[model samples]
Target: MKKYTLLLVLFFALTNAFAQVKTQYFDENWKPVIQEDMVYYRPEPKAVNGKYLFKDYYKSGKLQFEGFSLSKTEEKFDGEVKYFAENGKISGTSEFRNGVLDGSVKTYFEDGRLRQDATVKNGEEESAVLYTYKGTDINGSLSLYDLMTFFDHDERVKQIIYDGDPKGIRQESYLSEGKAKYYGPDGKLLGELIFDLYGNPNNGTMIEFDFNPMKVSATRVFVDGKEQQLEKI
Candidate 1:
């Protein structure tokens, strides 16, 4: 009688275990499960308080991509996103916030060099500075310089320097009609002239001299004709 009771108890326990395993094989509708919604499916849904949460990976498991989903929202939230090289280095990492790129995005070359990095805001490119082995500008021209600045929208303002020194610069003043009138080098009036529409000299006067010899050597003023002014050095 003891042997028969023990066999009966073992049979009932095995049957109960089998029944529980079978129960885990069905969907919420009690249908045979072949797809993801089934309880026995691999990579099972991680839940908290009956709410679907994010996915986590074990150290032994290979995770190519991973992210999260907040409750009642379809957007994925903060996560550590990584891509691996075929030879086993980190190829890139793209950060995200609420399903939009809201931080820095970095990418590396195959040789483990930092190839590119950029800042993104809400999926829009805010400001990006790129580095490359061979890069070109808007005109499709390459340069050997390390840095270049461009002004594509505004008229370029040029200043003329005298004696190849910026400190000895010249000022170009315009008259009431937007015409260049007096030009001074290093705060001293060098010459005064008027220009036509084509920048040709009209009626004007110019005082020319030599400085190193310390002499008011020559003065030619053109009002209607060239007039020489005599002065002491």
Candidate 2:
């Protein structure tokens, strides 16, 4: 990458400030990598006071992301991480508290207009995200379940993916009848779903909550399998 050469020139200039800035390489999956297979790289030159830098760049030399990873493995991202577009504009930023997103996650348009402003607390969306859906502000425009499905949050629904899987590991409820109760990782009640014999949601309410205060965020009502409306609380 042409940017690799430019980094070399800059690297030598700052050699004195860095105790040892090893350029760690990673593949698309962020696994430990060699230069030949790298899609991202970061030279955590040094830590000041107590914070270490976690800056990643694309092979093209354009900035990719600047953030704080809890460890060199880059697994537990615990702070605000700003992602950049190819043209170097900040595309988005996410706030994480020890790996779980717990605050504002925002994205922007290329012209620098706010695209989506959603708040997440302890990994759950609360309230409606203000966004221009097809060029109009869709604030309070969709129900919680609608917004969840819109952002693909249903993928997190628990399912019976394996035999004898632990309660914390199930993906989606496979109960073919009656009601099913879902619990959060903290063992708190999350929601309930009433499935018909055909394994479709027949009647019930799906809920979202703010974890810290342990309060209901928004609710979606379903009657005879037809969705009702969103109730923001």
Candidate 3:
């Protein structure tokens, strides 16, 4: 009689454990989506309390990206994200806060050299130090949110620094001093220009240089606070 009682108790315990495991498997909301070798989870009820996993795959059956979102619903990303190259190597990694980039982001070259290490705040570029694949500093201590402006679409410039005190509501007048500098991709100073306190290049000297081998190429100076081209004798 005691043996029968013990057997009955063990059977009930196993039955309860199996029921709990089945309950945790997934509700009707989660549907497995398989595209080629990629798999993803899509919540049926757009809003539900749970953690969701996301993934992408390369055509060769390798993982391209993997990340997760934590919330009461599967809305926005709020955790770590990773990316991979076609060769299945990690290419980049970043953290996200509510779907916006909020922390450190690092990228690497195909050869595994660190390409960039930068920070972002509220989805805007805050500060950065650029480098070459060979691990050389192309530009150091770059503060994009503080004092910098790009005229040409390309931003390989070091000149035209904006000195301003952005303290209050009037941001336009905060630009105290303005100066422009130009540099070559080889990291040599090429030219310089001056601008008004308000960042206008109306009455300023512009210097040009020849950096194939560093030297001064030409000079243009503004006179009478007006536009005039100087003719060489």
Candidate 4:
């Protein structure tokens, strides 16, 4: 009798799980669309809650991009979004936090060589490098976001420095006095900061990019007429 009851419960659980999912299709604008008009589509909606898996396709019906969204027709995206070429090679991947691109994002060559590698936070591309298909490194940070076949945000670069454990440094106006102290590789000095006559926080003088999403908090070390804030994010 207990075994029979268990089987009944299991059946209902699986049925409900399947029912929760609903398939959706849409046009380029993400409006409610018919099967023939859809440029984008969703998984049969089941088991998805706050985030829904969504995909856009090329006219050839090859997946052009895929990501998670808050709803069927809206792209308030969260988590990692991926792009692909018609040939199905992954062209790029961008990590999004509440619809804003954040963390380590990269693009690749068809042959799978690294094409672009970047670190971003709060919709800002703090540092990035672009590589030619032939492997020449080019500055593809900030001003170049639009040229890429992805999303766009206006980034004004102050400076870019190569850094580690997957981190890069940038300088800003507020750090005119203070310095950036980096402790890593088991707490050794990776400090690259400036000491103002009064001391404060950064730009070309300091900052890092991480998809590892290191603990970052902006705490004010000093407050003056300008009230410059220090961000250790």
Candidate 5:
């Protein structure tokens, strides 16, 4: 009977020691802060034990960001996240599922003005609403589909999509000289663009054109932004 009791005590002792070790490791990666009588935790690419509220701070001890992370298999951010500017103003907010962006996102300007509002799904943008710094509606509610057709002739305008103007679409496409040429998300031919010598949209200098899906037909000759309409060959 005494031997059994001794073994039980030994088991508890080891368990407590193991728990302390884990706490030490976790504390090493996460910095603890207390602001306005509220405790916040910050992480820096380290391991944890379970669900924890993560936070970041600015040099002046202001809360910079906050979110939740699960420490299983890997420290994956999960749930709604928020970011703050140095001046204690909300900068951005988004939802995350296991580290993948997956929900509505909103951002604000430094002067506490709404800057961007968008929806994300599976780490890709679905729709977005843009606004100017002075709260002007620059681009109305735009979906990835809408941007794919916004500027068919103006590459400079289409380049806004690549720069995350409203909704960011990770299509198999790229921008060249202000022109965005690529396929749609459904693997279909979206459209193409033509640029002049000065990388402007003009029919005078026709370098290349997309005739079919993923097929480029090369046939044209015009030079130096000169105004000369070429005969269709």
Candidate 6:
């Protein structure tokens, strides 16, 4: 019985030495506080000037979260918050200043690949981004099916399809330009054949024009291709 009592006392001593404080803070009147038994008290001030900080830990003693606060206000200034994998590699980081999130936040996958990046301004989500399929660039050409922008509920700013490509065959549209347009074998506009102000085709605009009388020809006109002002002669 004496030996059992000594072992119980030793167990309590070791437990007391290791049971970290889960939460700590100050009272409304700026008094030093400590919490045990799910209750708080104005304990004798230990450490520096009434500034309260709290730390939580994993069962293994690895820090889970920590932050600071002033006594009289309801604001918390998180210096740095980190999450870790079970194997101890850092999995995430979030930084705050004066209670505002103002730094980069990153999260990593279990294999340590960057999973997400988010930007926070004043604790609001300014931008949250994700990445996928590392080491590859997006391929394929732009087409009319893709929306260029949105104007309103009914009016959509879409890519005007001419011969299927967004750039069109002659690469010309309602916008004003200083060049003549060109057409391809299928009578579809290809791109703008740039001409100097003196009406000479620039090298970039040089294209082969097949002079076949049997091929159907179209005229260039203003007002959404409605009124034919000029015809192919």
Residue 14 lDDT in model 1? 91
Off by over 4 Å in 6: 1-53, 66-75, 134-233
Q: Could you estimate the TM-score for every candidate?
A: 0.34, 0.45, 0.41, 0.42, 0.40, 0.35
> What TM value does model 3 have?
0.41
Can you write out model 5's per-residue Cα lDDT over 1-233, one digit (the tens) per residue? Answer: 99999999999999988654222111223443343333333434344455766666654568878777785324477888899987888999999998889998889878786767777889887767555422234467323222222222223233232223233222222344444343433444444445555666543333333321223344343344344544443
User: For model 6, what is the alpha-carbon lDDT of residue 215?
Assistant: 27
Question: What lDDT tens digits, residue by residue, belong to model 4 across residues 27-146?
Answer: 878687877887766655222676777777765778888888776555778899999988999999999988788898999988876778888989877777654331233575333211
Each candidate's lDDT (Cα)? 0.47, 0.63, 0.51, 0.58, 0.53, 0.48
The clash count for each model shown is 0, 6, 4, 14, 0, 7
Which pairs of residues collide in model 6? Answer: 169-189, 169-190, 169-191, 170-189, 170-190, 170-191, 171-191
What local lDDT score does residue 67 receive in model 3, on the 0 to 100 scale?
Answer: 72
**Which run of 10 residues does model 5 get worst, by summed lDDT?**
21-30
Best by lDDT: 2
Instruction: Name the lDDT value of residue 32 in candidate 2.
Output: 80
Ranking by lDDT: 2, 4, 5, 3, 6, 1
RMSD of each: 17.0, 15.2, 11.5, 14.6, 12.9, 15.9
Clash pairs (backbone) in predicted model 3 = 159-181, 160-179, 160-180, 160-181
Q: Tell me the deviation in Å of residue 211 in model 4.
A: 35
Poorest 10 consecutive residues of model 4 by lDDT?
Answer: 143-152
Q: Model 6, range 1-233, lDDT digits (tens) per residue?
A: 99999999999999987753433444444355544222222222223355555444443456544455443234465566666765677788887877778776778877786666777767765555453322323365332221122122233222222333334333332223444455554666544444445544443433332221222254444432233254553
What is the per-residue lDDT of model 2 for residues 83-142, given as tens digits with 9 covering 90 to 100? 998789999999998878989899887877666777788999863333332223356443
Please give, for residues 1-233, the per-residue lDDT of candidate 1 as tens digits: 99999999999999988644221233544455664455322243344553434432222333323445444234365544566554566777777776678787778878776656666778875554344432325367753222211111232222222222323423233433323333334456656656566654554654433433222344445553334453433
Residue 118's lDDT within candidate 4 is: 86
C-alpha lDDT of candidate 1 relative to the true structure: 0.47
**lDDT at 154, model 3:** 29
Model 1 residue-pair collision total:
0
